[model samples]
Target: MEWSKITSDKTALSLIAIVFVIFTIEGLFYASFLGEDGIINDVDYTIAEEDAQAHWDEYKAVTVNVDNLRQALDNGNLSLKLLDEDVSIIIFESDKADGYYRGYANGVAANQAEFSFGENAFSCYVDLGTHSYQIAPSWDIVDNKMIYAVYMTDYKKEEQRHEEYPIDPLTFEISNEDNLKHNISIEVFNPSSSLIFSEEYSISPGEVIVSPDISEFLGKHRYVVVLDGDYEFEESATVARSTGLGSSEKLYFNFINNSEYPMEVGIEVA
Candidate 1:
C-alpha cells in the first residue's frame, strides 16, 4: 500500500472511533435523565420535591388559636390540647410506628400560644402537678389540607383521668371489587395512643373481608384506625362512641383498582 494512503486510512479509523465514543456517551447521558416513558425523570423528581416543600411551607404558616380550635372540635375534628404552660408537642410522620421523633412544638402560656404543624401525626405532653400526662391524637389530611386542630383545655389535678373508657364492639368490613390482589394493613390505637392491634391481609378480587371483632378483645369505645394498602381509604379515622340506642356502628370500605399502569385505587366508604 502507498504510504500516504495507509496514513489516511489510519486517520479515518481514528475519527470513526472518536465519533462512536462521543455518540455512546451522549446516549448514556440521555438515558440517565429520561425514563422508559420518555419523560425526564430527574425533572419530575425535582418538581415533586418542590411541590412537597410548598405544602410544608403552607402548613408551617398556619397558627391555631382558641376560637378556630373550638370550631374544629365542634366539626368533629380530632385534637390534643395543652391547658397549661410548659407543655411540649411532638410530631411524627404517619407511616412511622417506632416513634421516630421529628421535631417539637411547645405551648407557651395558655391558649394564646401560637401552634403550627405539618401534615403529620401529633402527640402532646403536659405536666400536671407532679404527674406528666401524654396523649397522641389522630389527624387527617383531606384535599391537600390538614383537617385537625390543637388548643388549650383546662384540667384539674383531681381529674387523674388515665383510665380507658368502655366501648362497644366496632367492626370493619372491606370488600375488594378490583381485579387485582391488594395488601391491606390495619392499625388500631387506643385512647392512650398505644397500638393495641395491628394486622395485615391480602384480599383477592371480588373478595369480602371482615376484621375480627376488634372491640371483643380491645374493648375501647374511642380508638384511632389507620388503614393502608396499595389503594386508599380514609387513611386515619378517630372512631367515637355512637349516640344511637343500638351498638357502635360498623365501617364499610370498598376498594377498586381503576388503572392498570399506575395502579389507581378508588375507595368508597358507606
Candidate 2:
C-alpha cells in the first residue's frame, strides 16, 4: 500500500474509534439518571410513587408477630423466634464503661452496634450482615433473672431485592415541647447543592409545624435544622426507609432540649 494511503486509513480508523468512545460515555452518563421505569419523567415518578405506596400498604396490613416472653441472659448468644425464624440475639452488657456493646451473630462479629435510650429505657442496635435490628426491653430488669419483654423497634433486610425509586415529598415536622418559644430554621437541598426549600418558623410550646410537600427533588440530600436558643438537644433522627406510608418514611430529626444552650444539627437524608 502507498505510504499516504496507509496514513489516511489509520487516521480514519482513529476518528471512528474516538466517536464510538464519545457516544458510549454519553449513553452511560444519561443512563445513570434514568428512573426505574426506563425514562425519567413525571409519568415515571407517578408510577413509582404509586407502586411504593402499594408496597407500604401491604407491609402495614401484615400482622406483627413478636414473642417478648423470653428469658433474659447476662451475656452470650440468645436465640429468639421472630416471624417464624430463629433469629440469633446478643444482649449488650450493662457493665461496659463505654456503653458500647460487642457481640457475634451467626458466628461472625456484628458490623455495627450502638445503644440509645427512650423514655429512660435502654435500646440496642445490632447489624448482622444482611439483617439489622433495634431491640429493646419492655421494662427495666432488676437482674438477668427477669423475663425480658424484648421487641424489635426497627428491622431491615439487606438481602431483599427491589426496584429503586426515589421517595419524594420529604415532610419536615417540627414541634416545640419546651415551655419557651423556639425559632427553628429548616433547610433542604438537592444533590447539586441547590437550595430547594428553606423556611424559618417561630414554634410555641405545644405547637407543631409541618413543611410543604417536597416534590421533584430526589436522591440523597442534605437536611439541616438550627434552633435559636441555648438548649441542649438530643438528635433522635433515623435515615432508614420505613415500610409505612406518608410521614412514616420521612426523615425525622427530633430535638429534645434539656439544657439552655444553642446547638445545630445537620443530617443527610436519602
Candidate 3:
C-alpha cells in the first residue's frame, strides 16, 4: 500500500468509495440501533399553505410559537385575519362571550376587562382605564409554552403598534444604548409557581444576552428576567421542550435586564 501507488485516479476513487461506505454504515447503525433519544436536527419540516390548512389539527401541535400569531396581526390590524399560511391559529373579533371583556382602544372604555378562553384553559385581564387595547397572557400551558388569547379591538380606531423587529423564539436580548449599569436576574418556573432555575448577571454597556436551557425539562415552563439594580424592567417568556430520549435536538432558556429603556426581545430556538 505505497502512497505513490495509491495516487492513481482509480485507486483514489476506490479509497473514497471505501470511506463513504464506512460512513454510511456508521450512520445507519446509529440511526437504527441507538437507544438514547436526542434532539432532532436532521429533518426538514416544510409547510405548504394549502396542505397545512387541510391538516389544521396537526399544525397547531407542532409548537406554540406566538410570534407567528403576533406577526399575523402586524400593523395592529393590517393583516388581522386567518392567514392562508398559518390557518391553524384561529382568531376572530366578536362582542360575545358573556363573561369575557374587551381591551378598550379609545373613548369611554368598557367596564369589564378580563377573559378566559378555550373553556377556561386560559385567562386574560386588561387595564380598562387605559387607551391601550392590550390584555396580558393567562400563562396557560399550550404546546409547551404559556399562552394568552389577546382580544384586541380598536374602539378609537387607533392603530396597535407593532414591534420594530421580528420576535425571536429562543433568545432574550436587550440593548443598552446608553451603557447603563444594571443587575440582571433570571428565573425559571413551572405553571405551579415552582422554581426550576435561577441565575444573575451584570450588564456593563452595549447589549447583553442570556440563554437558558429548558429542553432538559419535561412539558411547559416559564422564565422571568428582571433588572433591579440601576435600571428597572422585567420580562418573561415560556417554552415547551421535548425531553424524550433518542432525540438529536436540545433547548434551554435565558434572560436579560435593561435600565429605564424599553427592551425589545425575541426568542430563538437552535
Give the best candidate by TM-score: 1
Runs off by more than 4 Å, candidate 1: 1-166, 178-180, 188-196, 215-234, 245-249, 256-270
Every model's Cα RMSD, please?
A: 22.9, 24.9, 21.5
Better of 1 and 2 by TM-score: 1
In order, candidate lDDTs are 0.35, 0.37, 0.31
- Residue-wise lDDT of candidate 1 within 1-270, one digit each (tens)? 111110113344344221000000112222123222221121111112321211021111111232443343234323343322333333332223343233233432322212222234434344433333333332332233322212222243223221232334556766776687766676665433455667777778889888776653221223222224332222223233332443344555555554422122222222
- Candidate 2: the clashing residue pairs are 230-260, 230-261, 230-262, 231-261
On a 0 to 100 scale, what is the lDDT of residue 240 in model 2?
Answer: 33
RMSD of 2: 24.9
How does residue 170 of candidate 1 score in lDDT? 54
Best lDDT among the predictions, by candidate number: 2
What count of clashes does model 2 give? 4
Question: Where does candidate 1 have its weakest 10-residue lDDT segment?
Answer: 17-26
* Model 3 root mean square deviation, Cα atoms: 21.5
Error of 2 at 112 (Å): 4.7
At residue 158, what lDDT does model 3 achieve?
23
State the local distance difference test value for candidate 3: 0.31
lDDT, candidate 1, at 256: 59
For residues 1-270, write the lDDT of model 3, one tens digit per residue: 111111113334334321000000112221111111121011112333432211022221112233433343221222121111211112233333442323322223453333333432333333334232222333433224443222333333322211222112333444444445556676655332345677777666665454553333222345554544323222333332222222112122222232222343343333
